[model samples]
Target: MAAGRAEETTLARLPGYLTHVALSFVKPDLIYQGGLDLSATGLQYPYSGTVLKEAIALLKARQPQLRVLLSVGGATYHGWDRLDEAALARLVRDLGADGVDIDFEPTDPRCVPVDGRMRCADDALSIDIARRLRAALPRPHVISAAGWSVGAYGEGAFADAPPRSPWRGAMLALLRSPAAEGLDLVSIMSYDAGPSYRPDQAFRAYRAIWKGPLALGFAVLPPANGGPRATIESTAATLSAVLADPKAGAMLYALRDVPPGPPGPDNPDYRSLATLICVTLDKPGCDVPMP
Candidate 1:
């Protein structure tokens, strides 16, 4: 669920909805708190003391089996620098979460230098944080990161093209680095691909370099250039194809955008597609049908 801080007020209302409304259709094994981007909240780094503790208590009480994770450093939290190792270790111990999700995007100005170099001093810091957290935390928790897609990363064959940008090589280097080895999953943000959004293009671009589990992240919005339904259908078809490959899975970009509303279950938005995938995937021998 891509929940906002406001939604935390109504967090209690979720379990019933999950059991009756959502689980009735799709059984979600994990629920990542849309964000804990402490940088946005004007808090200090390694937020484990008050904020993360409360988040863990609230989420764990609702569903024990549901792996609750805290997502840090989103597109907006770019100015965030290195985290103190002691503070990070404390955070990992305090939160007792299943893992953390690093979602640093390149567009964030804080990462860009006036000299045009990608300021990635924080990358090494993050990797060290993960290593310490893994050693300190009692159980082996999964660490993940959200990355931009192949077109977005501009790596492998998509290095030079209309979608290619200066940030592509830097993004690819980050993903391929040993720093990313501790990660359990790397979700690729594939929201803004052009009108001719083909999943095969993405598949071909990433298949060679990525040896780990991959998740396809996409948005439901139509293109400003005029293709709306085509974009949605293409994304769905692409995702379905990706999921057919054992190494890939589909992750809806958000949940709030696909609220249950008048458009009904057939909507191609994130929530609907997520629900559809979860239900079909959880049940084997159940026809993998999409509405």
Candidate 2:
């Protein structure tokens, strides 16, 4: 059997080869209820920090190689607009996460420029939050963020019309800031673009500005209005090529969207996907050498 296939069987049994994988638990709400951040509230999340600490301990004990991060802020997270740094740090410590993924999406009317000029308020917030989170959190903890594609600068999807950008200011500022030095990874959300969007091209564009470990982000499911769906094999191939540089990695948009099924190792769709990510397995076929 193929190496990933073999591991898949083992993972289904022992379920520990999953150590090679990383997962994110999002929006525990640092400011909710006066800083008593809970994940199971309003969001209807049965799996929140309410049981996360214990869960992390158990998972880590079994796998000893599993990695999990806490994602603060989602599509409509206003609390992140003016973050409470101390509260956020405390939450990170409490969860015992590998790091924090700032999922702050800048869409508030307030993010609009003062003079109707281009600007990304979220980008400014990203730099500040990343810097503070990096400093506040203990050493060796990851500080990562989900960013829009270079096309976020308003690259026109069609051939016609002048290209405009709303986030150009933020993008430029982030590239210029020394504060970005504290970030461990910058995963670019490369979706929501016309069919012309290429992962390799997007990777190159992000590399030009932010000189850090880059993780190419794509959707496992078909995009609603933009781009094409990527199959597991194609995603694996793309990730393999990107992983040529040890510092780079690949990220799927989310876990919530995956269809309900057996554990990742047992489910064919999840297993096939997990196989490509089982880098720590150190098994043949799992190591997708650069082509």
The local distance difference test score of each candidate is 0.47, 0.54
TM-score of each: 0.63, 0.70
Where does the lowest 10-residue lDDT sum fall in candidate 2? 155-164
Error of 1 at 188 (Å): 0.8
45-78 per-residue lDDT for model 1 (tens digits): 2332345456556756765655555565565454
Clashes of 1: 0
lDDT of 2 by residue, 38-135 (tens): 64222333444445455556556656665556776766565655566666666656756577776666664232344533345465666676777778
What's the C-alpha lDDT at position 113 in model 1?
34
Native-vs-model 1 lDDT? Answer: 0.47
- List clashing residue pairs in candidate 2: none
Best by lDDT: 2
